[model samples]
Target: MRDHGIAHIVETILDAPENMTAVNEIKERAWQAGFKAGYNECLTHVNPLFKSGFTDERSGFHGIDIEAVYAAAVDAYNNLSISAIEDIEKCLEAEDYVDRLRLLFDRPGEEDEAAGDAKNDAGTSGTKVD
Candidate 1:
């Protein structure tokens, strides 16, 4: 049996130009989705107050610093985006491991036939016979 490691699988994937393009596209989309989610969450918490001009005359003085809010939103967006990309990378690595393990253990063309033979020999209850 040959050893097919996760690194080998990853290297095979990365070596293909098309796969590299696809991977880049996937990471870009993940980053965009994370940024949108983070920005939307920040808006949910701050949009109402800011929409009303950040002041309520009846309730004394109220203010929201636009620069500070923008900075915070950017920071949150960056953090979320990075985390999303990392998660995507981790999933890809895990998939590579699975692929490597499958390649290492799965014999082509014989597995299905062997399984069928075993099932037929064992009967429905799966008891082995001598």
Candidate 2:
């Protein structure tokens, strides 16, 4: 699993005007929730809100204020004292994400097992990996 930087994500989302009101309402609710919980609970919440490489229309998030969700997630991430936000950003950007992630994490992706079989599969079944 990967934890994207919710704070930056929320900020970028709120960057667009149409998302303004919805984000604000969510923030307000988060504040109320904090009061009820006796602490700022928004400081803890991080999970995949959306996949790394998928585009979704705003309407699909009828009740989900992306900014709020991200804000809480980022807070959770920071509080937990962990690091992986940068890699997630690169993954979201769609520009050589895997390579970027490898560089950020100081490792390389798994060897492509299908590479050797691609030509054989294509010749026999007219199917290709890409």
Best by TM-score: 1
What lDDT tens digits, residue by residue, belong to model 2 across residues 49-109?
4334322222334355655665775465335422244436656476455434434443234
Per-residue lDDT over 39-114 for candidate 1, one digit per residue giving the tens place of the 0 to 100 score: 5566566768677442232321124343444455455544443333343356446534333344444456534322
Clashing pairs in 2: 45-73
lDDT value, residue 89 of candidate 1: 56
- Candidate lDDT values, in order: 0.44, 0.42
**Residue pairs clashing, model 1:** none
* lDDT (Cα) of model 1: 0.44
For all candidates, the clash counts are 0, 1
Residue 34 error, candidate 1, Å: 1.1
